[model samples]
Target: MTTWSAPIYVYLWLAGMAGGSYFAAFLAERFAGYNQRRLTQLAIQMGVLPAVLGVLLLLADLGNPLRFWHLLAEFNILSPMSMGTWILLAWVAIAVVMNVLYRYEGQHGEPGGRPIHRLNGGLGWLQFLFSILLMSYTGVLLATSNRALWAGSALIPPLFVASAVSTGIAVLIAYILVVAPVTTGKTTEYRLPARLLTGSTEWAIPTRLVGRLWEAEAIVILVELVVLIGLVAWLGSSAMAGAREALNMLTFGALAAPFWVGVVLLASIVPLAFDMMSPGKELARREVFRVALASSVCVLLGALFLRAVIVIGGQL
Candidate 1:
């Protein structure tokens, strides 16, 4: 019998998203050049809410939320849950501080902003590392359960990480489209704001930034596809009956519809197709936002359904 509940499923999903957001933001800051500040700010903002909520949910699921502090009082290096609790506590503090600093920098316009920005950047790296650990921790927690569906293989962590990244990129893309200013002309258009975190810059900068983000999202989607395939293949070849049973449940059993319709098609394939056919590159700025918005919605839905199917299906 399964002991986990809906809250657990949601907790897993939110935790992964939070981790992925931080990792994505860190990457944007490191490689996105002028766009780093905006992405970093967006990433941190995106991460903190879900993360804090997820942690709260996890604690609530314990029946007495305050009991979570017990884990902190009693340290156990060998316990995944204890470690995760500590990590969550640390991440929440860091995320809150980062958000406050980022908002201050943006509003005040670089009065001693350089040092603060650098400090945030340093913290971003910590977030990046913690995010990966957090992503892996969810799977590790499941695997530690000794259930054949989860414990039969070590691939769950990698698969979860890949999906988390793809979902994170989808979220950022959606956010950019929703929040960024839109510019349209006869032949060229831009979807991001003219003035980013550093202040008013040329339109060309954000244009290039969007292009890079699009390309990055595409790459992450491709990677997710590959990882999903590999996970299935590994499960198929597993000698454990439990593993094979879990695989069957996911592929052709009660959960098949969601796995196929939500995870494989809507989340992965649809977005890929939309990216290839998006008119945003042309004069259709509206079309671009529409496509991005649609894909992001799909990815987010798929991610939620993916977690639901996996958690519930495993028990079934």
Candidate 2:
């Protein structure tokens, strides 16, 4: 049996989850209506938890969590880990401020409820910027390592971004399905704020939002697949046979089943099919909800698997 270290897996999982959740919140806030405040709040709460935990896991792996403070005291932009730590701190700070603003606005309730609209707008833009940083840092963290398999791959950052976006969509879909039903009793016509989350309503979603999100996810997944295939092919052609063999393990070895079946087919392809089907105006609400939920779960699993395979392959 191959002995796996729990700390490494924990780091990978937490980073992906944190990155994915932030990306999801950022996107929903940009495109969705009235629900932006709620979604932003959710993003802050959800994103912070994973980030904090992931950092702790990384510290634990070092065997002395207190030593982590030393890294903060010393500033080194050239170091990928150091850069990532700074970025994470910025992201957390911005997210917290945004969440607080969102809460304050929610409490007042009106066009003139709060006077921080301009500040909120600025914070929203800052949130998006930090989100991109957080998403890309995961790939940078791995790529900077001396490991041959992880280094020299410029595709890693984009791949991480794509995975983050795909996973974000999945999280949004799941959130909507679970929470949208409760809003049926709300008499007010839902209007999503500029920085809040939104969902399909009255048993039907706006065609534009649903269609756009699905299309974006499809493109991201396809691009990710292409990158993975190209990377494998390149590795095979190189003199590093060990690296090539390790990459192949992802396709034909123990990780093959999850990579091919769970991540590729079930997560990307199946969801694409459902999106393409467009069950129509007459489709049952329950059926639509089920499809969305299932696709979300698959995407989440795929995101997790991507990091898992990479981390394991590096070890091999």
Candidate 3:
């Protein structure tokens, strides 16, 4: 067996998680009316770190990190990595702006109350748009690679999106549960206090919004599984069976546990079950938190495994 460096895969996983976390946090804050200050703050803070690290890892993997300026000095729209670099830079800028706005709003209490909130609302939409692009670009970056398995596959972007959504939900849910009392100032009530006390005619909206995002991600996961299986079957039957066999080293060999258990069963199936069963009621709070946290960790692991398997499989 030939050995290979796998830091790039790790970087990809981290970047995807960061992007997804940003997307989830932005959407949850915008649509759900969920108001845990620490939750949003933590998400914003943690989300940027991975993207920065991923970029650094990419540079390091290139054997000369200093040469990174070449990407910007000489732009190439045709290159996915080049495109990804620009997209990532743009996303970093947006995240910084959102962070500043968030802090400013907290300190200043929104100009004239409603007008400042309105401006924040506009900025919130921009944040969400950029977050989605940040998450989607990871897939686009991989899909742009000339590698046969990664190239020209419609399913890759969606799969990456699904993975992002899954991990994003996970990170948000974990943060909410971890810092619930600090944000809500009530340790006893399991339901998000932000929803109940806000009185905005939009109570329980964030929970429902999160639930819907989870459901959409689950659907995408199903589609991804189907596509991956179909590709394996088709490759096995065609002259590219050797390539298919190497890929199966992921499914049936080394990476099987993570692929089946973490990705398929834990990240996708289990979350779908909980999401379908949970009602936006205080009674279901414990169960909702439990499932969300569990699935989020599983999805994070699955995302890592997905990249690891692909990079390793390709080298094989």
Candidate 4:
């Protein structure tokens, strides 16, 4: 019997996405400084929404949203399901707190005062750690499972983590593109405030800030592609008959269309091409954002399809 349905597949994807975007933004906050302030704010603003949505989906998958608390009340060190439940619960709770902190800063803070709270620095680290764990938990669950497609596969965890970061970067880039205007409008339009992060302002592009997101996104995309290829190879050559069957299903059988088109082409090759060929610094500011928006949309679509293949393929 299939243990997970389509909703579960979607839940897994959204959960990883939430973790990735939140983690990357805070990480950039540390390295990119004030230039990336909007990135951090937007990331925090977005981080919790998906997580909340994923949780609702999870409850729906359970067939009894009201009984979710029963699962929370128990612990099973031996069960991946048990551990995933707690990790997700903690991740969502932390995200809520972090989001509230960011909102509070946006509304009550002075024009020139400190933007983020020192307490959030500590919370941010915790959030970062949990995000990594949350992303990895999905793969770890599969790798430890009895299914021939997932069992004993070492690449699964890193593959998921890389995809999470890749998708996360896409989300932030898309958010930046929409929130921060690049048109040569009046200075007041900048959301990247001279003192705060806004949607309309920066007459000149923050090339370095955008560059950081791009470089990181490209690197993770490459890593995900490598791991994905390695995973296919590993499964194809496995001694297990079930593993080999799963490989065939993915490579040339029923799952081939989604795996090849959605995961391989859309997720890895095409998006990588567009994302890396980013508009140059001399390019018109509006054009730069256009490319980013395209990349983000492609990456998100690919990510959703990736989990669909993984979850469904494993069962087959």
Candidate 5:
């Protein structure tokens, strides 16, 4: 298999993040009641912006942004490239639709009800389906390759999916902490006590919402941790000599710093620890914010570091 450039790895990672963010938001929208609409809407809003950036980066990587449509001009079911191209295109379209409908709901609809659009259910399913495909595609793109480290690896898809979702949650947490406080718009029916907004309380958003998202993120990180270890063990036990060597590189070799410090310590363990200790009905907001900020920064950095290790290690 040909070595992919840094842009390719980033493209795959960012695309997964974009999709995963929408997936997390979509679930919030679907299951949570209408009162939490603000949170869900904000989370939903996170998807399109990153997706647009990821697409633009991909176009730039192709050397001529205009020629991107050529990718859509073919349909090769047997090719991972073809599958990814169409999946992202469709995922972007679905995200745009979801955003448009959400905005419309915000502007001209009953304040205390779920989105009234008739196609909402169908559109949501598409969003959910495509997000899963997009997240899985990132890892599949690598695994289907002939590279010894990735060829027979069965865990990359699940690993990437879990990590993508956790990072998506991190993005939501970071954004809400920094941006939601200053916003004056009353777009949803959800209301916070004056204490929460006035800095007297321990929370920025409601306790239930914050608790659920943190819990979800922590759970996904644990799953990712398990998958990561399993991937390492799989590589260690591989028949191919290169695969075993790749495992060593991740554990105690050239790539060890990023793998251990960046991914294991910062990304998984540190964030997981913070998340598991999530405050209950009362705690200092700054304390929670600090922990969240640290976790978010760590997860985002760890994600990039992980892909770097995987991509560069595969080549080595």
Candidate 6:
């Protein structure tokens, strides 16, 4: 019997999240004019681990793990798997180069670093493009399958992209909160009364960008929320029985608890509510970071749950 296991789901989640991280970091550093140093550093760090880990997981999941090397030897422009392998290989090389160049400039304090940095920045565009393709390829890989649940709708790729971005922002936010220093006396801190009606008493007020980062996270989360709604709606309306079954599994089947509580409630809504608590205004930086950290954790967990549910539910 054919089966997709936990490792496959993990590979999918990691690949998407990594692609999202690279794309998010690239955009922030390139066009948004954010803290290029920090963003680039985060990008390279985030990209490398996932790129390596995803491949490892993929290999382990294969029945014949050693056969993985054949991917490089094989060349089929028409094969999604073959193309994805090439993209993955290229992406890893770019990530390593970025990491090396960034660290070199930092250690040597090279005055000529400007031109080198510029060249590296130019490569960032390639990273972004590869990221987009890599993220979409996950959905395309599944959709090309004969499985009705996977092939029923054209929205999977876009949905995956949105989710990838949302999770990517979460990962970046967590990294920033952990690594970046807190600004002292930068803004006044204030707290609203806790929602007694809702049960919890903790209050949160968001402060904008420790420089320009958090704001971007909020924007991506919002976009993901919108795309998520469309994804569900599209899937629900799909004429295929497998699609309906898959949707049912998510909404009211064995996977319901994890899908709703883990993915929908904790992952999507909670973070969204936290971000909306204070938008574009400066408040307590620590408090904002705390809330953002909480959101990031939830988003990451939710992202993992999403892949598990989709992979398993589709088959059922």
User: Could you say which candidate leads in TM-score?
Assistant: 4
Superposed Cα deviation of residue 184, candidate 2 (Å): 5.2
The TM-scores, one per candidate, come to 0.87, 0.80, 0.76, 0.87, 0.85, 0.85
lDDT of 3 by residue, 72-107 (tens): 875687877777788788777766766665555555
Which pairs of residues clash in candidate 5, taking residues 3 or more apart in a chain or in different chains? none
Model 2 residue 239 CA deviation (Å) reads: 2.9
In candidate 2, what are the lDDT values of residues 1-316, reduced to their tens digit?
3233556655656665666666665575566764434555555656777777877777887766778888789779878788888887887777677667665665566576457656777787777777787788878877776555667457667777777777766665565555543334523122233233222222323334543555566677777778777667766766653666666777798778877886678756777786665544112255665766676787778777777777666667
Per lDDT, the best of the predicted structures is 4
CA displacement after TM-score superposition, residue 316 of candidate 3 (Å)? 1.8
> Clash pairs of candidate 6?
none
Tens-digit lDDT track of model 1 for 93-137: 888888877766665666677788888878877877888888888
The order by descending lDDT is 4, 1, 5, 6, 2, 3
Task: Estimate, for each residue in 31-112, the C-alpha lDDT of model 4 and write its tens digit.
Answer: 7566435555566667778888888888998867888899978899777778888988888787677666655655565452
List residue ranges in candidate 5 displaced over 4 A.
34-36, 63-66, 111-116, 182-205, 279-284
Which is the better candidate, 2 or 6, if ranked by TM-score?
A: 6
Q: What are the Cα lDDT values of the candidates?
A: 0.74, 0.65, 0.62, 0.76, 0.72, 0.71
Per-residue CA lDDT of model 6 for 1-316, tens digit only, reads 3388788888888888889887776776556555444554566667788879988998888789888888889988778778888887888888888777666555444586777787777777788898898898777777777776667777667767777877777777676566444444664422222232112333222224332555666676567667667667876887876767777778898889988887788767887787786564233456765776787888888888877877777777
